[model samples]
Target: MLNLPKEKVIFAGYATFFMISLTKTTNNRLKDKLKTKSYTTRGG
Candidate 1:
């Protein structure tokens, strides 16, 4: 087992969670944009 300080561990956990959430939101935005583009193209 690797020993780490408590603060460092918590920071790492928060950082990882933040990054995952950021990526998820970014992906969702991209998907939304693609969907809108498709809809407009179909309607036009």
Candidate 2:
């Protein structure tokens, strides 16, 4: 019984970490896209 609860907690923590990292990665991609588009429009 103790092990079961511990396992669930670990899984939840890993899932949370994964989601946070994924969001950060997506945000970076969006930022890069916007920068490139702006540069191209500016003829830089």
Candidate 3:
């Protein structure tokens, strides 16, 4: 009995996708920064 409108549901789906992508990218950037810092500390 899920009676939801089409456009609203689609919009919400897209919003969720964008949020997930943003989080993944943000995490990746943080990981890259940590790796860079570790390498620099070890190398120097």
Candidate 4:
């Protein structure tokens, strides 16, 4: 077990969580844009 400081461990956890959520939101936005584009092209 590598000895990491407590604060560093907590900070790493929060950073990882933040990055995951950020990626999810970005993916959702991209998906929404693609859906809208397809819908418009289909004349919906």
Candidate 5:
């Protein structure tokens, strides 16, 4: 009962952070893929 509200609040906070973190992680993944492709093409 009481725990439900707290859980919801905590979930909301984490959800907000997750949205930002997800974008960062996605960008990092794309950068990593580009690096890999460049390295393969350059034979390095």
Candidate 6:
């Protein structure tokens, strides 16, 4: 029973870390995509 809470805490920590990294990479990809789209629009 005592180990259960400890396991939950560890799981939550990893979840938070994974979410943060996922968002960071996705945000960068969005920015790059937008930049290229805008540049192409302006050039054409």
- Best-fitting candidate, scored by lDDT: 6
Q: Cα RMSD (Å) between model 6 and the true structure? A: 1.0
Q: Model 5, range 1-44, lDDT digits (tens) per residue?
A: 99999999999999999999999999999999999999999995
lDDT of 5 at 3: 100
- Model 2 stretches astray by more than 4 angstroms: none
**TM-score of model 6 (CA atoms):** 0.83
TM-score of each: 0.89, 0.93, 0.87, 0.87, 0.63, 0.83
lDDT of 1 by residue, 1-44 (tens): 45568778999999999999999999999999999999999999
lDDT of each residue in 1-38, candidate 2, tens digit only: 89999999999999999999999999999999999999
- Flag the better candidate by TM-score, 4 or 6: 4
The full ranking of all candidates by TM-score, starting with the best, is: 2, 1, 4, 3, 6, 5
Name the lDDT value of residue 23 in candidate 1. 100
Best by TM-score: 2
In terms of TM-score, how similar is model 1 to the real structure? Answer: 0.89
Clashes of each: 0, 0, 0, 0, 0, 0
Off by over 4 Å in 6: none
The whole-model C-alpha lDDT of candidate 5 against the native structure comes to: 0.98
Residue clash pairs of candidate 3? none
Q: Which of the two candidates, 4 or 5, achieves a greater TM-score against the reference? A: 4
Model 4, 1-44: lDDT tens digits are: 35668778999999999999999999999999999999999996
Q: What is the lDDT of residue 44 in candidate 1?
A: 100
For model 5, name the residue pairs that clash: none
Cα TM-score of candidate 4: 0.87
